[model samples]
Target chain A: MLTAFFRWMRLVLPRGDAILLAIALIASFELIGALVLLLNSKVSPVDLQLARTFFLALTAFVYGIYRVNEFHPLAKPDYRRWLETTPWTWRNPLPGGPVLLVPQDVVVLALLMGLNRDFSFQTLYIPVAFLSFYLANLMAINWLLGEWQLAYSTGFGLGLGGLVFRRPDYLLLIDLACYLLTRIAVQRSFRNFPWDDSHQPCAPIEASKLKGDSANHRLGWPYDSLTPAKLRIGFRLHDAICFAVLLGWWHLTLLWGADERVRFLIIALPLIAYVGIPLLRVFPYFYMHRSPIDVWGRIANSWWVIPKFDCVWIAPLSALMLNFLLLGWASWYEWTVRFRYFEVTLPTDWRYAVSISLAPVGTTAVSLALFLIGPKLEHWRLTGQHRIVFQRSQEFTEL
Target chain B: MIQLQQVTQHYGVRPVLRRIDLTIETGELVAIIGPNGMGKSTLLAVMAGILSPQHGKVIIDGMERKSTVEHELAIRRRTVFLPDKPWLPKNRTGREFLMGVGRLYDIPDDGLIDHVERLLNVFELEKEGDWPIRSYSAGQQKKIALSSALVTRAPIMLLDEPFSGGLDPSGILALKHILKHQVQQERATIVMSTPVPELLEELANRIVVMRQGEVIAYDTPTGLRSLSQCTGPLDEVIARLVHPRTMENLEHYFQERPKC
Candidate 1:
């Protein structure tokens, strides 16, 4: 069974051992860092608890995503075809379709538990609830429908229940019940697998139901859902909305007489959500859509050109607008209201001075950086080759 | 003329087409007949610009494929390559898919609509045309894919196993009449690969027989029959030219079977 699992892993990961080694090295580094953090005496109990919960929840979320992707019926039709036609049968124990747990998962769990020995039973239940929920619906009739939501909700509910009840005994009972139910459902699903029924013709009535379901229809950004121009406009609109919300929250925090730290944190949310996330998503599109034909020469050039052009122009403008809004809102609030609820006062003058000086400068810096590195990054991504930074030593041969 | 000049292709280390050279003239119906795994599909793919050959070039109407994006696009506008297993987008209806293909080939909207309706009727797929391609059976999907190719009205049509994929007798007869009309009236050039050469013997102007990534023979049906000294069907001539021991192996296998 272990051999079969390894063989399956090898088949799935054809990029060879380099990727596996990279993953292992990264995991080891994270574990060592986590252990060092755990051993520190200055670390507060709240910080430790937060770290533990974040890592555990992150593990559960990553595992849930992996399982959903692995079990998605339409994700890899070629792989499924190969599996169905191949002579190899699942050698894992019955009732548990296939043992997809990798060595990294076990190592991560062990390291996490070892670092936090005094962890509550709820921390242990987090992974169990998530895994059970995924297993139950992994082979369900409508596995695609709300599978991620179910897994996440189960983990969240279990963790919350454990915290509220403050009773490990009841939490254990609930966990056991969930596990048993998952086991029975999985066993039945495996016994009568719906391989043939998977290809059932969807009824015409289902089409109407899916008319408004953008989640199901979203193939990818800027690929199937929207044209390049539309995607650019959509991103601009999204950034504008984020900017408005952030400014509103900042004003609210000011009105409530929050401290400097909270105010600064509130302002950072829009930067992360709008600028960072959009930049990350735009790279692939940039790489895919770069073209030799410019806008003037050809009416229909590469799809990436418009999006890239929009990013270069619109992103900086949006950032500047957000900064202006922030500065303007602070000025208005300072002029209109005087707060006596808290000791810390809003530094409206310094805020205005910093916003005015830094807004255009920061925007210009970001724009320049994007213009300079964006195309290079796109090229590097498309062509999987990179020039060596240092010259190789002639005498350095394989040992 | 569509010319493959010393074209060679390899999937990994295994060579599928080994320096194949062939010229297919305009309005010519060329049949690529061979045993399985003999690079017939690879040849068609190279010609269609779907797969780039490792060596040599594919030239269509004096424009070399892969020389420039504009050149490749020009060739694509004039050619329609139907792969053996056409991947139809599941969410789209058959009519929508055909129309999309027509639009891609820059067919006029009015002409495209009329052509799609005619194709659906001719292929007897009018009932299934409105449904999503996901709900289509293997045969219906093949018919729709064929309809898409026909809707293009391109001068060059490269079909890989058009008959073997799943077509009723009537659908096959309709396709035959359609291809014949396209070749004679529209002066369209066609290159199709098929395992069964009997179907193409009467229709194809020239037959190219391949064996293990190399062309063994390229001649007219009558020329091949005379060369092989076989008065039987084109399949028999193909077998004798490419796989002489196929009949012997079959006889041996049958003799080895236990008496019933």
Candidate 2:
């Protein structure tokens, strides 16, 4: 686990100190926000402040030491020259090397030390921290319901470092196993592919060499030789799987939580129409440029938006269709069961139509105004030019 | 004139173009001839002002690096680069594409239609000029791209592998005529990079040979032959320089084979 964290930390930080500092600041601010939200609800004020200070200090300290130590893959063994050379790594002769410690592990240990008032004897009770965290996770699982339990195990555990607390003592061992799995899968899938040893640790290339040599590789800057079509298949597939899983979980959770069929339909309606259609790629991502030419044709035919007014008929038509579907289903249920019909009393007004038309227009005008003024405001504030530097070396080094 | 003084371009540490100096005079027809991956495209890109070099100055006329907007605009306006792979605006017809280029060059409305029509006729593309370029064959697409470059009367033309797809006799004849006419009328610097020695040898006023990202020789076809020490033909000399291994076998086969 420590090794993975070490690799991840190295991966996230870029080559230059300035970029490294900026990234650390960004992560630290996000961490601070999460901590503040966690503390604000029911936690004691003193405890909240202490926790906030501790997190900030820990983050700063870890990042600072890492920077000071120059714990970077790009800065050793003639780093400048290595960028030009084919990246490779030597085999680790010792299979069972010393287990690495992650930033989280160290933080936990530090917290334990503080709690026990054993600052001088920090390493003595590292095992206690691991055991307590594991016990907390195991106890937390019993309190979880069906979907929550699955969410805890997969999304929370696999994605957000919850799994680390479960088996903190054997964290390194667990990470090694996962690493082995990933390696085996990669090797089996790729076989003798060019990037077989791509993940192996290597040194950085010189800036001079990078500039000189990478000009003719076709993927050079100013002109990206990449075809957008090549990425579509994988991107679509991944998005579909993620959306399907999330929706399935939500539906299952709602089935357990809700009792009324209409309530369930109402909840599911927003998910399917507003989110699911777009998520599933059935509807296009953006409002504009999604079959722009086709939309223009529709506009010309008066099947879409009205000129100047820019009021789209599709939204209102779709809303009416949805309302009719719901109302019709309800009326059928009422007629069959001999229940009361409330449709005659319900109001249908033009105010809703007017508001709907105004909403997107108002929002779009505001957005356009913001977009035009944003750079000017930033320039005024900073007294610096609004320059977007797409430095490729930063990405390569960060990775 | 575009000047490259000691310009070198490297790709991931390997030098593609070594330190070199060259001046492309106005109306000069310079053809870059070299083996594949020999920085011919890089040279074209640099000359077109599409790329920035590592350790050299690329000045167009008197415009140095990031000097003035007017200079850059002038350079861009006067230059029309037909990339090796043509960028056909999908769903846009050939006429529209030509019109777009014409607009960019600020061509007069009265002359635009006539200019486009004439070039289309010359390239044998007038009948299908209204059709989307995506429907055209590779040869036809190349002709359209070449015609677009020609229509603008851009003083500097950088064509990377222009004669890639096969051109019919009439098309080839017409293209040669147009190029010759450009030199006579507009003083356009038609710099093209082609691996095919025969096509370039006939039209190229000067040929520049490159190897391992450096210019090996730059001279006229006859001058290049003299430098290469070839007696028979210019193509044979180029073959000897570019692909020496096949030359002996080719010579033997030609000598041994009965007169056809």
Q: RMSD in angstroms, all models?
A: 20.3, 24.7
- Candidate 2, residues A87-184: lDDT per residue as tens digits? 43323211111112335545544553454333332223243334333323322222121123332333222222222333333443443343343333
DockQ value for model 1: 0.02
Model 2: number of backbone collisions: 11
Give the best candidate by TM-score. Answer: 1
- List per-prediction Cα lDDT, in the order shown: 0.58, 0.50
Query: What is the DockQ (computed on Cα atoms) for candidate 2?
Result: 0.02
| CAPRI tier for the interface of model 2 | incorrect
Per-residue C-alpha lDDT of model 1 across residues B168-187, encoded as one tens digit per residue: 89988998999999999999
In model 2 chain A, where is the ten-residue run with the lowest total lDDT? A225-234
TM-score of chain A of each: 0.34, 0.32
The reply for model 1, stretches above 4 Å from the true place, is A1-399, B247-260
- The backbone clash count of each candidate, in order, is 0, 11
Q: Model 1: clashing residue pairs?
A: none
